[model samples]
Target: MPHPAAEHSAQETVPQAAPPPAPLPAPAPSLYDPPELNPGAWQRAGRRLLAKTIAEFAYEEILVPVRRPTTASSPVTDAPVHRAAAHENPSDPYAEYTLALDAPGERGAPREPGAPTGGGTLSGPGTPSVHGAPDRHGGATGSVGTGALPSRDGAGEPRDRAERPHLSFRARRSAYGHWEVEPDSLLLVEDGAAPAPFTDPLGFLTRARTVLGLDGATLGHLVRELSATLAADARLEHTGLPGSALAELDYAHLEGHQTGHPWIVLNKGRMGFSASDAARWAPEGRTEARLPWIAVRSALATYRGVPGLDTAEQLYARELDAPVRESFDAALRDRGLEPTAYLYLPVHPWQWDGTVLPLFAASVAAQDIVPLPSDGDHRLPQQSIRTFLNVSRPERHTVKLPLSILNTLVWRGLPTRRTVAAPAVTAWVHGLRDADPFLSEECRVVLLGEVASVAVEHPLYDGLDEVPYQYKELLGAIWREPLGSRLDAGERARTLASLIHVDPAGRAFVAELVRRSGLAPEVWLRRLFSALLPPLLRFLYRYGTVFSPHGENAIVVFDEQDVPVRLAVKDFVDDVNLSAQALPEHEGMPEDVRRVLLTESPDFLPQFIHSGLFVGVFRYLAPLFREQLGVDDAVFWSLVRSEVLTHQARFPELKERYELFDLLTPRIDRLCLNRNRLHLDGYRDRSERPHAAVHGTVPNPLHAL
Candidate 1:
């Protein structure tokens, strides 16, 4: 049973003859004529674009202080919430901070009146109105919110108390709780303060244009989103105000309270924050509380909506919106929401990636490079373009894909063939059209390598060259898959669990996933959670309340048993937030340290916990199992929680050693409490909801009361 051949294909480097390869076509004469790939261009552009984008968020999401919090104690870096004050009066001057109203309506009027509000509706059928707090089923407690359920400042404690800074804004939880801010958003600087316009709107907009290479309309959309955030802030302060003119008010200031609200909690499998009420609580970060990537990606998607950029992809791309509400609704109906919560959030937050590179290549690259595609879809269409560096390598169809399928994707259009010395070489290549400018370099490489398929008795080695690089770029680009790839999707995903490096069980588990799934789509997940397994269950981590999980990225493949046999995960668009790179503690942990250090980013995990697991796996995947398997929902979450805890009990060393998991335990509980009940007042009123001024029509978007 020991297969020496089981060694990963990447490690098998046998010296052989290097076959002569066909000459590559000349590079295009124009349009980035500089033959150099300028891969650095991506970094530079990405940096500049990021700064400008940050600038766009300057007043909205970005918090700048004239000085450190007068009261913040040193050493504790966590963003501290305002503590309770001895003298408490809800009607005091310090209680009038800004908060955005929940923008109204069901999905009916896709087009907001006049200019667009940069807000999209995510409410489902028969949504109850907010009384003071919000109530409905499937809602989770936490700052991110449950539905468009209400909860805000004072829901916790006092945040900041100041004379109306002449700038106040309102932020409402769009259907799935992706916060939408208003551009040209007003500000209320107390009675005497001056509400100034954003000083650097153009500077911000231009920078976004350069970094993202966005067209006019895309840029415009971003600006609108920016403005909306500002406006929403204004609305929040204005709506809550009950004071006199500037002359009458001196030290009188508003100190909004949202102290009691927990930032995260687990609801069944879904993650919810203060979904409904933003104006009262979480105003400082209200404008852009969406799943980190969703906020940006939605902006990009909207940018493509602008005319004249000559970008039709985003204009036509169908996006899944609002898995939060969808999941909640499904929960009510005894059904499961679709499997992609991160991909389907209802609100259209700002986005930029889709308008750029991988956004376009998602399908093209995916279809072209995927060998088996899925289980039975092995007879893939040759139409999927293949790019090759040289014909000396084997064609994708002829190559032994093994685990390299992922590598091929990372080093897209690169070679996979392992080379030795070439005694006699013969290969033909032609696809890099000079004048015709036919295919992307990606295509040219794959096509030419396919041609090299001829004249090599070593049929396998013939296409080796092109395959390795492609495999490296695509698959080797990241670390988690390789780690997970080595495990079995089924048989209790806990085989290696956290023992990926120290224990042989970990290695064996990795081997199974690698062999069976081969980096396919959603297949691994199904295989992972069928039973009480650690590594299998650990694979289900999803984060935060954004509705949709990233789709163009994560992929899975199931075998003949209709379970995940091969799986691959892609896209770190939100890697900055979700990755574990920041936690230096992670590097010392078990598993592939180099891969984790070199490829895995810690930033993405915080975000992933919010986006991928909270929305994707918890909200999406678990429900899928409940529906398909016909099981109770809470039992599913309880089972997994029990397994993880039980495992921790079994291995005390793991609890002491893996600090990451140490930080992981209680988060699910915190996220589940009061997350759904947040509203205008400090405590929630789940018993009573808003009653519309008019019975026939739905409650006004701002106040169902």
Candidate 2:
């Protein structure tokens, strides 16, 4: 029996004559690789990234660089570096770079007698180093080739501090009162001093091994990750579009240009990607490839959806128009398969050839999995490597598939439990938002619901205990509602990540948006805070719920003038967290919703806001505003405090919840993500997903405000 179709869908409004897919190379040419990966491009990208790696690691307490006052007698090197004071000085051959440390570890002090003068130690739990290619058990890959894992010039040579042009040496008293700068740390000091246009991230990491206190294994792995990051940065730099130009691009195009998570230093280290794969599939590559869809036997796969979607046919009808649906069904029939017996889903082309073909060979040979022609809809990869934007049909839903690459801290695969529960969780969250008049009527906050999902269990790994999670999560897809059609006239949307983006010209994207808004910098900042904070605060206090409103998860909606007006949130099933303390608001939540949503204590609940939003985002944005807009740090933070206080005053009835989820603690838990990568896991697979390492604490900048 033919399934009844919905009257209409978002596709109805799509313009006639859809853009044809761009011509492909005979053997599938890379979008932009040859020119972007040039030596000069890699050098510029490496230098800038190396400076950031040092600054961020220091800020996070992963590396402790003892600060001493700078003096006129500070030994200077002939190595050219961008001076701190002039960030955008045209005469300076490099971009704005700052040297935060003063003198090296104390000079002329006993350096353990024959100890070489590098600098200081970055010490940690001394794990033994693994050399050469990492074993399958996740030791370390030897090097990333041109991505700069090892110094192309040479490796492991002990160059003294006095001889290195970028390094300056001065001894500081150690815990035992003897002064000596390790040879490795001395190189780090030089790199920071003469950074930008002349820095090497991989080389710096190798030299700083003693100071970093990293064992051979950790240092070698870190170098590889940094190298991959440099390669991505090089591609981004070669885009040649300033933030202003990037701003003018549509939402999908603009997403491809983002610089990625500001806090994670190794943000773009897609470990599984070769240089060719990175060029074709990585977001910064800006390649729009047609996706290949597959049909899986229903008996071998499970799917769940919200109220409106009850069957595979309903989902297909809602997502694809009548003509497209018929074409898909006919194609399945042509392959001598019963269309009704199989569920159709989009596959990431890379995954189709790499993991799926090898792991699911048995299923394919048995005719349980059948391939369909490319959908012909051009799609661009988003910042999250596995998710894709439907560029050919702008109003269509974004499709997310599992890519089994280990990036940042975890394998980039969707958990089967979460994938199956996504739609139901989305429904529960949407109901809560719609029930609140303020969220719906006043704020018009959009919840980009995950409408449907399919999870295919691995034949061998599904029921096995203690197997690496990557196997179980190997095959799945989620379809989320797009944000395009939801926007009102003259309104524009941008991810919160874009706000911190700085162009090659040293102009910030936020600064440009503010200039276009014609509002004073401080006033513009208040508007942004007002747009983003209230709904999030209300979710915590009124609904006993919170979201990981980090840069990518939270979107700022702007009006015709580019002044921020409202907030839009996404990534619900995986990121939304509920208060462990049961409240009246959650009484109606479905069992599946309860099972899938993470529950956190109210005391730690504010981290979703404090760490994800304030620290993750404002920690970086505040400084950018201070430098580019002349809004001092104090002033920038005061505006943020004002927004929180105003929200509190508006809902006095929820004052108890506000106190319970306090955001103004004197010190906040310093969650270290990189430390987790280096010390905790180090590219190894674990049964449980990785969590951020909480070192000690950072004095909360919001305290006492």
Candidate 3:
């Protein structure tokens, strides 16, 4: 979806009389020969994904690698020493590691010294090989290492070097004990063979399958997901714009350029989508279409909205133009149906064709559900895949429809109960923000409320709690406030996730913004933290409320000069959680909201910030700033800690609350996103949604400060 921060030009939002309905665009020719599936693009995508897999898998403790000792050996006094010996210095945080894996196939014979390995090239000392494209930050992709021995015994002798294959890379352990592996430095050495560049993610997964504890079935599905992800990555790489160009686009258009979730290894594992389906519907597809509306019998459908949208009529009056509403009413009348007997909502074309029609065929045949023509407003799909932005009418509410594809961790479907209670939840949260001076005046945080919703429960699955959760969430739509309408004239918005994005040329997007802002990197970053943290902290410490402000949910609003000024958050019904302790602040929470919203202990509530923002987004962003802006990762984290402390100092009265929801504990549980896919959930269908698995504890950087 559009970066939550994108704003519309003044001319685009100017008032105009409603015109004739625009005709739907004709279907394009089939994508039989997709151009982005080239070998070069695929290989580059594979290398980058492989590096991510190794780093994330290692962090989750799913595939542990032994740290290789960095012993210095002089070239003149002895033979040429391993370059990793530089890591022996106390000031050097980098370390060498080796991961041994079961050999996949017959080992090849040893090749001639200094000969080119089949897969990729090896670099000499001081000059590391960069695999794919030219990286602006020099080593952003990674730096190749000298051909170091894979492993050694206690006696310093090579241990069965010819027996199995092993991967060696240089990495640095940062705050929270996070491993930052250099992608270009990855080298794979086989039995008595030369070290080749490890560029094949699929091969790496297969070779390390046993080590990763993947079962046969899980491994097969995992491969398909990873492959699909790689294809999407390749497409992004093929069509990606420079960071400078991306910065100039409006929020709705910018969403099309974003790479998917930063932490999930299979971020784009859109399981239910075919190649063609993805090309037309995926966020990266960047295509806009008019969504077809459907009428569900009032008996089977439930509508909820905030105060002004108390009834469906009010929402339809604002959302649908006069002619469109007349046409929809005519459609219902033609079927001998009373318009008042049905609830109208938009359905994603893909969802209508692939899910609703087939699964709810009986309802369609019985006239319980009827399809209507599009409202004629063309919307672009946002990064969320299911949510759509109204490019045709910037002032219109963004529509979020239930898309039954399995992506990232769960089915991309709205939970039935959550959907029905969405507006109530929004009303309660909006009440909290509006009543608090700190949130309303000081921070001025934009809470893009889910103002209205229509939930259509399945005829059979809605009652079957034992069935997979997706079935209960088959058809629904949520109307959210448009970010464009919420922004000031000179301001633009971008998702917090966009801050960590790196373009195909390895140029960091943040760097571009920093350069444009004409401010020091540190200053720009401090402004960012200042904008994001205060509001989130106020909600957590004083109100016992938290939103999962991970990259996608938390948006950074920038001023004319591109400096971050405020935060904008969305996805309230799904992401907002409260404390189980029942604070006074929650006294005003509506019954429907209290029942539907999940609650965690005060101690675990901070994890929504720790895991969602710190570990999830900033963990990756810290390393990027260090490499791209010459800022130290330690300093990068220190700025974050300072922001928290500053907020805490601003509210001395909430000292007890700060202690109760401690964010500065020495260590926090390592919420493993990748592990959930590999071990915990593993493509299994369940009655409930899956959650991130906690593998171990990680050092909290804020604690060090």
* Highest lDDT scorer: 3
Encode model 1's per-residue lDDT on 129-198: one tens digit a residue.
Answer: 2211234222321121111112222123232333212123322221111222232343323334475433
Judged by lDDT against the true structure, how good is candidate 2? 0.71
Model 1 residue 208 lDDT? 22
How does residue 684 of candidate 2 score in lDDT?
72
RMSD of 2: 15.5
Q: TM-scores of the models, in the given order?
A: 0.25, 0.81, 0.86
Give the poorly placed runs of model 1, Cα more than 4 Å off.
Answer: 1-527, 530-557, 565-610, 623-629, 646-651, 663-705
For model 1 the local lDDT of residue 621 reads 33
Better of 2 and 3 by TM-score: 3
CA shift at 435, candidate 3, in angstroms? 0.6
Pairs in clash, predicted candidate 3: 1-382, 1-383, 1-384, 5-493, 6-251
lDDT of 1: 0.24
The full ranking of all candidates by TM-score, starting with the best, is 3, 2, 1
Q: What is the overall TM-score of model 2 with all chains considered together?
A: 0.81
Q: What TM-score does structure 1 among the candidates reach?
A: 0.25
* Alpha-carbon shift of residue 93 in model 2 (angstroms): 24
Which segments of candidate 3 are over 4 A away from where they belong? 1-31, 72-92, 104-159
